[model samples]
Target: MSTADGPSDKNIGCAIYLHIPFCVSKCHYCDFASYAGKSHLLEPYLNALLTEIGSASVQENTRRIGSVYMGGGTPSTISPETAEKIMSAVAKKFNPSASSEKTIEANPESVTPERLAGYIKAGFNRLSIGVQSFNDRNLKSLGRAHDSQRALEAFDMARKAGFKNISVDLIYGIPGQTLSEFAEDISKAVSLAPEHISAYQLTVEEETPLWDMVEKGTVIMPEDTLLLEMFEKTVTSLSKAGYRHYEVSNFAKPGMECKHNLSYWLGEEFLGFGNGAHSFINSSRFANPDEPEDYIYEVDTAGRAGAEILGDEKDRVLEFLLMRLRLVGKKLTFKELDEKFFPFGRHDKHGPRPLFDETYRHPLDWISKNGLAEVNSDGFTLTHKGLLFLDDILLEFEKV
Candidate 1:
């Protein structure tokens, strides 16, 4: 896919994220702030969400919204009217650009013709369908509600419903999964010809069923080498299929990148609404209460949900570096870094360094010397081999 440039930073447009915390069933490895068997809370939750949206102090005149993403446990499970109401509230609050990209996340089993039509009518131009795996056994093992066939059908249905910009999400490294099986999954997804693809490794979070199973020896994760092999295969296969590996875990066909997610990775300001939603604006970062009841009660009683500020200069710099490195696999330029994090001239004759660079310089130097990254006029960029150990590299930065 063609890797076209995204919107210029000078536009100053922000993004909006609306969280839908409902799902038909929770996956074994899932740890997001979503709940199952909470269908009854849908009405009250939507009401609370609408109230929060309406009450948000967004400066629409100054910061025009470029994108709005409706993500959740399964946003498609909600009725069309509810979806419409949510979009209506957004329309009432924000002034989206003429070509604003609006996306909604849905699970295969929860998607339907009616839901697709409703989403389009509500101004959603992109759909992210979670099809974790195309293998029946893997789907069953993951406790996902949809099977391989159902996932394909859902994709077809979305296409028929006029969703041209579609993204499919796939997971790799499931317990007992073989390399060939993963390759086949990638092949199937390529055949479907989605505009975008996101392939993530399965992480066994603590307190989750998958973690319990691993502790009990009932589930065995793939070895590190095997996982790396899978990652390599994903990159190779997707690249061959005309998808650009734009981000570490995401691929897109030409100008089809997920703009909303790019906003986050690029460190742009955005407003998030609903339970457990986070917002970064005016140099302040905060999150609403994670629990639905807490969120509802707070919004109802206080006329606004409370938020906890993240922290000061050091914290913001750390966050900005962490998020930006994941894109273009590169470090920030001295001028860029200085302007955003330390405007008071932290650079010397050699180059610019952050406040905490004293402790981190050695490790970063090692990374550069070891060829894990390259530093030059542009900035530091991870080598192809370095992408595999991205977490380890980021940990070194975190220690500083």
Candidate 2:
């Protein structure tokens, strides 16, 4: 075990996230805190990460760990030995139980049989491979290094190296991708029978090359109608293939959901390490510096980065609702919400409190009336139609 504590009501084991910020190449649409062409800084980054871990280790004695996830620009870009050292440090610092689900994210081109074996030997039990797309043209357009064939080979290599729990990532809505092409990608991914699958829509972020192309009319996005069709197709296809549509964009085999991600949605405590990694614990949410060099300097000088405490009740309530509502099957019960946020029942004298404030109440009522959601003593959940408009629904919360 990595830590000394046991799971409890208030502390149900924390999750640990390690951010590996190095990538072989940058994807045009990626906005995550990762750097390309920073190979030379790998050793220095790892050393700083180790220092942070050592400083945080004492807290682990009181916190049992439930999961460990290493995400990156691409964790596979680093050496297996480097990966192993990281796992060793985590194991020493956190003392997680034997059953803790340890996962490492890899891109198709960066994974090898030897790397997979090293991950397993280092105590990682789960692997998340980023395939992005199965179409070579789409891959090139997305700036992904691997072609469809390489993606298949990487999945095969992970399986051969004894990874029983695997997740495959796919993206849709590329400018040139047709509905039929996206369907074929889904079918091929299902055929792999991975324990989990994540299908994400392509969004153009402001600082990315995709955004510039879209702004300049050099690349046109798929019509909203077409994107909706693709989403519906994905849900229908994955369901028929025996994968549960667990979250909005995630599908998984029974009992095979990604626990680490679930923890985040469920508001569990987690500690994040490395540049730009975020943590939500002790009623505060904060992040490490986004720049690699800034992170190193901060940790070296102050032992930890500055964190923000989410102390406002209204802000907390909104954040909670936003995250929890993403889990389609898990609605927030009225009793739970009342006790945590409202405390007392709605009152006419004060013209309703923060939750029952007109700002939120009106939108929620409109949602229920429009058949976009259901509200009752049990709580609130999105209707199937509501899922399609989740982004708009979330906007309602933001107004409060």
Candidate 3:
């Protein structure tokens, strides 16, 4: 960790995520809160974010943040000077510690040597670069701003800038993406030798341009069988390359797991800050309005939400299980299960609902019997099959 300060038991349990909402250009498939051409809003947005974080800081009983993740539209899209300002305010609240996992998400297009060095000076220790593909045609099809060469150079520059723990993000199952091209992308990523690799399947969200393309006559969506075949190839290729499939979409070298992301996966609470950032604390989950102007105004002055503590306990428990099951390798013990794992509902008479009992027995038995999960003295975990059908099984939780 940087020598900025130290973390304590009180504050270290929470992870802080600061959303940077400006990208040079938005990828066609992206649904994140990022502006493609809005360079003008950067400074004011930063000021608003700082003011909001300051307000939350005063109210925070949680002492030190365990990790600080600078994710988003494109964190590195800002000039190095702007990066310093954001990092400075973040330090005032979280205080980057020796043990803190300080991560910043950088797009390949923004990873200049100076940018990388500036991020380090700003106290970011982990770098997640968006290197979504190594194939030219596929890269173009995805509307990525960087070419294969730029991505390679960006990765090289980050390593040259002394980023010891780096992660590269790759996407598979793009329209017209072949199994061979996908494997080649994984092979190239392995050759880079990053500390971690996050291989995500391309799922077209309803409002995304890629989805619209599928709706129109513009693009061909990969079939289910082909996607499954691609998924298997990805698992095989990455495994042979020494990357462990630690989570459904993430792979890492041993001991290089993303602590901030893992916290989310394991159902821990975090205070998500910034425009469009989502937070889960005290059994409720919600977000600041996704509009940059609205988010900044509300969070800076009133603090996140117009105070929306929306979503109930059952919704909370189901959401938690959905995220946790993404971690195919780890298991949460029963000791950690009780009140936190399975949230209960009030009946019509204001008593515990029948599903509360179902949480303890039915769901676990059903999944285990179906070869979707297994449990020991430790609590349940997704089996290999479970990970692939994770979303499907999570739907079951929503029902219970």
Candidate 4:
């Protein structure tokens, strides 16, 4: 079994993210770039993914990759053999470090003991299962195909299949979900003792079926106060259970934080594969076509498509601040800022402008005064209180 050291230096190694955009059924609240009932396109899509990976290997001149994340509509929806083919192509094309985190996202319904073992044989060292909720009523409300029992069994199967590193995904604030239900979900997840856990507050996107239900008064979302209580409960319960609150919505046991995601938060470069996937490299972002057919056509005709360069320095600065602040305990430092945004040490007569300059001072002042964050000579870090209002705090920074 391969072992990875903690997060690698961003400058030394990059990561790869592959998208598997097929699902067994569409969840009511999902608006991601995934499709349901598209099983017919599976083989064609797999072939296209391999072709694209080969093409990328030729163009992406880089050092060893630190991580490989297989995310999706539900990556486990594909057969293990097909999934293994994609992993094989990746192994052939890119040099992944022995310590690299190779993770695949799975839904409980699609996960089986045989499939779990196959994934391990295919070289995936980590499993991130989307348990969502452990309550049957809550699962049904969210349109999850699996019941609470199936989710428990999925964890058992994964463990029996010899997966040592696992992560459980949970969601709070679902329609008609009570604080007690959310607490129970947290308790059960902690009992599983996965290496990592991510608890996200559900956000209803506009075009999803859940939104229509909301509009028609068929589903009522929990009030903000209730959501806040649930969020607090998550932090308290998880912390007491010995999970470190690493990111705003993520917790981990010791050195088990998701490296692929940590690379993103730290502004490290990553290459994305599959339909509707996005990549960030050298201050530019690239997106593939959302439609599988269009993505296949583009990959077949050209190497890739959709390149957007974030040429504005301010935009880069703001993005850096936003991503860095998502980290809970880490402080964003001046050296990190200078290296990324001012590699050549670009500055006026004052040597280098202070990162907390006049433009950022207003928000910084407000944040510091409110005890939401700590600003020092080197850099800043948000307190736990600040993380709760992260969106609002970031908005203040954005406005300036």
The most accurate candidate by lDDT is 4
After superposing all C-alphas onto the true structure, candidate 3 shows an RMSD in angstroms of 4.5
**Decoy 2 TM-score against native:** 0.92
In model 2, the Cα lDDT at residue 320 comes to 78
Better-scoring candidate (TM-score), 1 or 4: 1
What's the TM-score of every candidate structure?
Answer: 0.93, 0.92, 0.90, 0.93
State the local distance difference test value for candidate 3.
0.78
Among the numbered candidates, top TM-score falls to: 1
Compose the digit string of candidate 3's lDDT tens values, residues 1-400: 1111111113336778888999988789999888887777877788887777766645453555678899988999877787777778777766757668999999888778988998898888999999999998999999999999999999999999989999999999989988889988988999999999998899888898898998997998888898888788878888788777777888777767788887787676787777788877665666777878888677556654435656676766777677766866566455555555434434545666544434557677777899988865557767888888887787776766
lDDT of 1 by residue, 327-390 (tens): 6544556567656765656575548655433435765687788787776654566777777777
Clashing pairs for model 3 are: 10-63, 11-63, 11-64, 12-64
Candidate 1 stretches with Cα past 4 Å from truth are 1-12, 58-61, 329-331, 347-360
lDDT (Cα) of model 2:
0.83
Backbone Cα, N, C clashes tallied per candidate: 0, 6, 4, 0
lDDT (C-alpha, whole model) for all candidates: 0.84, 0.83, 0.78, 0.84
Q: Is candidate 2 or candidate 3 better by TM-score?
A: 2
Candidate 2 lDDT over 1-400, as tens digits, reads 1111111123346889999999989998999998899988888899998888877846544687889999987999878898889888888878888788899999988888998999898889999999978899999999888899999999999999999999999999999999999999999999999999999999999899999999999999999999999999999999999988877888888777788887787677889999999888776788888999999888888776636654687788777766667665566666677666676566535565544434367768878988889876456778878888877887777675
Give the distance in Å from residue 394's predicted Cα in candidate 4 to where it truly belongs.
1.5
The root-mean-square deviation over C-alpha atoms between each candidate and the true structure, in angstroms, is: 3.0, 4.5, 4.5, 3.1
Worst 10 residues of 4 by lDDT: 1-10
